[model samples]
Target: MDGIIVVNKPKGMTSHDVVNVLRHKLKQKKIGHTGTLDPEASGVLLILAGKACKALQFLKDTDKTYQTSIEFGYITDSDDIFGNKIEVKEINYDFDFEKVLQSFIGPQKQKVPMASAKKINGKKLMEYQREGISNIDVYNEIEIYSISVLSKENYSFEVHCSSGTYIRSICRDFGYKTNNLCCMKELVRTKVGRFTLDMAQNLDEIEIDTVKLYPLSYLLDHIERIDYEPVLDIYNGKHVRIQTNANQVCIYDKEKPIAIYQRDHFDVFKSIRGLW
Candidate 1:
């Protein structure tokens, strides 16, 4: 009951709604999600059950990938089709989508949608919008690793980006760059770090008490593994120094991971998270 559960989220249910359902069925009080998916969007939603909630800090920085459809012709206040229609336009001419997609492949400052949960002065931006607030200036620096069209007929495309990147906002920006109004018609988060859609299971398919819990080492796919000699020190919350080729690695004792360590100083390995 204390590990990660990958849920293939269904559209129309907010991420919190899924968590509440699992919490009731699993009978575990402590349940949390790695990130959230909009009510209109669906895909991989990782639920941390019981003690696994502590793993959020470790996984929060992981990158994400999404397969989304950008519907051109009209724009909404929320940047998605669910919001109040603010503008409407017709496609007068063909536009270059590939070139515009490539231009977003680096660091850029993106404005937060008023429909988003991002807070301003301890209040959600959406809350401000509800209070008749307009044009609240807020921005987040995000990095887009890559983006490409998956199918033009379906207006489907894929994007790999940093943790907090908003696909809805990207759809809004794409239309602005192309001189046409656009909004996200659908969104599906296909991947979160090593967790992909293929590895996800539907919510109805899980039995909280009987579901197999993935080991903490599952998140260490990107780090190198090293066999270290200090088993007692690490278990006793002690730092162990070891020379490793990688800047960060999973330290193991007898093939069991003790902790994820990073080279903090000159040859000094510090424990980032305890796996055991």
Candidate 2:
């Protein structure tokens, strides 16, 4: 029960809905999702169960990848097709694909989606926007690693972007450059760090009775590993010293993770979590 489940979230169900279902089905109360996906989006959603929830903060910073469809000539209030239509225009661009791709290359401040979980003054920004509040400061600088137009159908195109970089916002910018409105037609997260959609199971296809769950260690493969026994003195709450070439590593006893150890200035190890 203490591991991660990469759920291929079906469209129309909120991320919270998936968590709630798993909580009931798995009969575990300590379940949490690493990141939130829009109801219209479907793909890799990391669900942490039991004590695995404690490691969420560490995993939150991982990069994400998505294959998205952007439709031109129509804009919506939510930036995606799920929202109310705001405007429509004719697609009349002899688009310079290179310039379009270059526009997203450097650093740019992206306006956070009004329907996102960003907060303002201790209240969610989306709630404030719903109440007619429009002067909120919810913008953040998101770096776009790369953007390649997979296919162009008139003005609609398929693209892939890095984590925190909103595909809808990219469409909006594209529209701004071409004098036509644009909106996201669809989205599917392909990967979150090392986890990919290919390795995920759709909600409807999930056989709870025979589901194969990956151990939490699979997700922590990037972290260095430390053997047990030498840290027995610190397993029960006291910090132990150890020699290492790295600053931090995941300490394990046999095959069970004991805790994450951090190296001191003098090369001593200290537990960060685990050892309950």
Candidate 3:
């Protein structure tokens, strides 16, 4: 109950809905999700349970990956298929698939989705937009790590992109090249940092008894491991000096992680998180 559960979130349910369901199913409070996935997207939702909730702040900058489809020949205010069609035009010219992919290269400023959870003037941007307000400006810098145009069928193409980048906005920008309509038809988050879709659990297929939970040590793989007798004394709210070449170490009580320590300026190991 104190570990992370990577759920393959289904489309149409808000991220909050997933937290609510898990809270009920797991019968534990203090639950939270790593990032917000739009209701239209599905896959790789990292849910923290119990004491694991404290680790959510550490995952905010984790990179994300998604496989998405873009439909050309129409544009919408919300950038996705759920929004009202704002423009439509026939696809008559030859589609330069390579050029379209290259347009998204490097860093770019993308307007946050209107229906996003981003706040503007202390209110959610979507809330203000609902009341016919448009003066608020909200944009974020996102890098397109890589893009591959899988296929082109008539006026649609499948694409993959890095996290913090919006597929719908990319589609809208792609449409601008030919003044055609474009929107995201489908989306699936395939990866989140080290976690992949292969390890995700589907809602209907979730089994509490068979649930696989990764220990905190799995996430701290980059940190060094320390095994010392006096380390336990320091880890137990007492300070002790032990000579070790490792600058950082994961103190383990047998197989379970008890605490993570980093060398201080005075060459003392300090606890990052104490396990209790």
Candidate 4:
């Protein structure tokens, strides 16, 4: 119960709903999720159980991949098909789609949708939208690592992007670039960091005896690791002397991770977080 659980979240169920179900099944109170997926969207949802909940901050910067469908010729209030229709326009299927997809590659500023759960001034943006206050426009830096077309006929494509990149916003922008109104028709998170859909299980399939909890080390696979000599120093959360060029590294004791250490200054390393 001190590791990660990958859940294949079903559409129409909120992210919290999935967590609640697993909490009851496992009888574990410290369970939490790595990130939230809209109830309308489905796919890989990482559940951090027991002590694994503390690893949340470490995983937040991991990139994510999604398979999404974009519907053209109509726009919605929420930037998705489930929202109320706000505008309609003629479809321009003849546009150069591949060129447009390539244009989105690399870094850019993306406006966060008002219908999203992003907080502003201590209140969630969606809550503001519910109260008829929709003037807030917030933007954040995001990068699209890659985008590959799956089916032009269905407007389905897969995108690999930096964490926090909103596929709905991408669909909306795609429509603007193509001169057609558009919205995200469907979305499925295929991957988060090293975890993928192939590793996830449907909520009903997660029985306590059969459910798998990936070790905490799997969460830090993207980070570098070093076997240092000072074991007690690492355990005590003290700065340890080391000589490595990595900005941050996992201090390991044999097969187990003792703690994650960030370079303090020169060759010294300080505890970012202890695994124990």
Q: Please report the candidate that would top TM-score against the real structure.
A: 4
Candidate 3 residue pairs that clash: 73-181, 74-181, 74-182
Query: What is the lDDT, from 0 to 100, of the residue 3 in candidate 1?
Result: 74
TM-scores for all candidates: the values are 0.85, 0.90, 0.85, 0.91
Q: Clashing residue pairs, candidate 2?
A: none
**lDDT (tens digit, per residue) of candidate 3 on 69-88:** 77777777678888888788
RMSD to true structure for each model, in Å: 2.8, 2.2, 2.9, 2.1
Poorly placed runs, candidate 1 (over 4 Å):
209-212, 221-230, 239-256, 260-276
Query: Order of all candidates by lDDT, from best down to worst?
Result: 4, 1, 2, 3
Each candidate's lDDT (Cα)?
0.82, 0.74, 0.73, 0.89
RMSD of 3: 2.9
Give lDDT: candidate 3, residue 17: 96
Clashing pairs in 4: none
Q: Write the per-residue lDDT of candidate 4 for residues 110-196, one digit (tens) a residue.
A: 999989989999998899999999889899899999999998779889999998799999999999998889999999999988889
lDDT for predicted candidate 4 compared with the true structure: 0.89
Instruction: List runs of model 3 lying over 4 Å from the truth.
Output: 154-162, 234-250, 262-264
Give the true-structure RMSD of model 1: 2.8
Compared with the true structure, the alpha-carbon lDDT of candidate 1 equals 0.82
Which ten-residue region of model 4 has the weakest summed lDDT?
52-61
